[model samples]
Target: MTTLITGATGKTGQRVAHRLQTLDHDVRGVTRHSTPRFDWHDRTTWAGAVDGCESAYLTFQPDLGLPGADEIIGAFAAQAVAAGCTRLVLLSGRGEDGAQRAEQAMTASGAEWTILRSAFFMQNFTEGAFADELAAGSLTMVEHTVAEPFVDADDIAEVAVATLLDKGYVGRVLELTGPQLLTFEEAARAVGGPGVAYLSMPTEDYITVLTEAGLPAADAAGLAYLFEEVLDGRNAYVTQDVETVLGRAARSIDGLAGGEQS
Candidate 1:
């Protein structure tokens, strides 16, 4: 049976596809540029992507926090099921209502589903949105007090691969986080050595920065809201889900600091 991995070129998705291939599973990696052309915006492409795949690793593009994600995810899940994809592992965010709605849709799709509700990714400092900022020797964000348990994309991919292959994880919702929590300042220092500076700006200023960095006004505001609302002492704790699910502790920032990123 083939396992289809959406966002197959992305951080976790790429890692998951490689891991599945090493494990000798039939892996079908789907990207917008793939032969079947699985563009998330084009519903017409979904059936072809799901065709002949017994399981799928579903990572919503941009994010599940974006508008209309629930409908698209729900519809895609239904399409996957109708096309005989029996299992699905959805990569979701920790504290977004939009993410939860998409999770609910996946559960209701009648496919054996596992949800990975992950904390902020460790890759944010290594291979993600903040990588450039950190590399530039200065990391800026909104108010500095909150700590986040930054989960590694590798751990997420491990859990996702296991969920897709193992029947025991069916219908489970695993909340994944790193072994420890760290503030943006600490994370910056860890990722880019002591030379990197961490700057905390006001919400408006941060939004302005994001806008100046090419984010649309609404997108910038949404991120500002996320930083202020979701990251405000809410998801500051750690979880053992990585160990519980994968039989190993989640990778820490220190572990990632010495490794190659996707």
Candidate 2:
């Protein structure tokens, strides 16, 4: 039986799919562009994507933090279970109400489920939203003293693969994070070396900067809210869940930078 991977082209999804393939597991990677297109907005395509798959890794697009994301996730989980998928793993964010709701929805689906409640990804600097600024030798953000225990995408993927294949991890919610916390300025230095500049702006100013750079106004506001509110010291601590699952320490931003900059 094949394992289905939704959002297969995304950061975590792509890593999960590649690792599963490396293990010689049969994987059906689906996106809005795949043979059996799987779109979060289109219910008709879901059944086809879940069909014949014994397990699935679900990554909700835009974000699971959006309103009504739980309903969509709940529906997808139900469909996956009804189609004979016994295992479901969901990628989720920490300390967000919407994410918790989505997790609850997956748990209620009656499938053996594992929720990977992850911290801010270290890859955001290397491959995601902050990549361009970091590459240009400067990074800017809302001014704050809050620190994040950013986890590696590869570590999350390893844990996902473990839970998918091992029934031992069934019904678990793994809180994944790096071994240490770092402020955004510290993170910028780690990724771009000591010469890299870190610029701090007020939350509103940061949102304005984002909007001026072509991000939608609503999207910019959401990002500002995330940095100014959600990330405000609430997630400063580290967790050993990655070490517990992977049998190794979670990769730190400095470690990731070392490897990437080598």
Candidate 3:
């Protein structure tokens, strides 16, 4: 079956695309840089990406927690339905209002949808927004000892591909997480050597650093709130959805850290 993967070059999307392609599935990857670009802000670009695909893995750029994301995702889901796409898999975050709204939109869309509400990714230290800071030998965040069950992106991609190919997970909102909970210091120690420091800074101070590093004000504030508010002992528990969907234990952060690539 033909499948379109939006944000095709991203951490999770790239893994999903590769897994699908290895299985001999016809895959089309769309990015803002693609020939028929799939810019989420441009409606005209949406149709071109959806046209010829029977299934799609949709990952919103920046994040689903951004303002107006609900409306944007809803519009794109409608377009995918009109283009004859039958199955949709949405990547979303847990405990965010906007993500909940976006999930609602996907549910109402005509296509059969699966919502993957994920915890913080372990790959964040190696390949994501936190990589640069970790490489610089220091990562800063708000000083909360609340631990999170950071899941692996590989697990997420596997689940997404499964959702697309299997009918069992349709209409299910899967909460994915790793097998254990870890604090930022513990996580840093897992990824980086002892020399790499995990500094717990004040929320406002961290926001200042983010803005100084060139993130927009809205984004910086959102991140500060995410680290300070959402992470306040809320998502400390682990889930078995990964095991349920993949029929195996969820990959642990320790396993990911000891691998060739972090």
- The estimated TM-scores of all candidates read 0.95, 0.94, 0.96
Question: lDDT tens string, model 1, 110-167?
Answer: 9999999999888988788899989889999898588999888999998888888889
Candidate 3's displacement at residue 37, Å, is 0.4
Clashing pairs in 3: none
| Candidate 3 local lDDT, residue 238 | 94
Query: Per-residue lDDT tens digits of candidate 2, residues 159-259?
Result: 99999999999989999999998888888889888888889999999999999988889778776776676577777898999999989888878778987
Q: On residues 64-120, what C-alpha lDDT tens digit does candidate 3 reach at each position?
A: 887888999998898889889979999999888778999898778888999999999
Q: Which stretches of candidate 1 lie over 4 Å from their true place?
A: 260-262
Per TM-score, the best of the predicted structures is 3
RMSD of 1: 1.6
For residue 229, give model 3's deviation from the true position in Å: 3.1
How much is 227 displaced in model 1, in angstroms?
2.7
Candidate 1, run of 10 with poorest lDDT? 253-262
How far residue 210's Cα lies from its native spot in candidate 3, in Å, is 1.3
Q: TM-score ranking from best to worst? A: 3, 1, 2
Q: Which regions of candidate 2 deviate over 4 angstroms?
A: 260-262
lDDT, model 3: 0.89
Give candidate 1's TM-score. Answer: 0.95
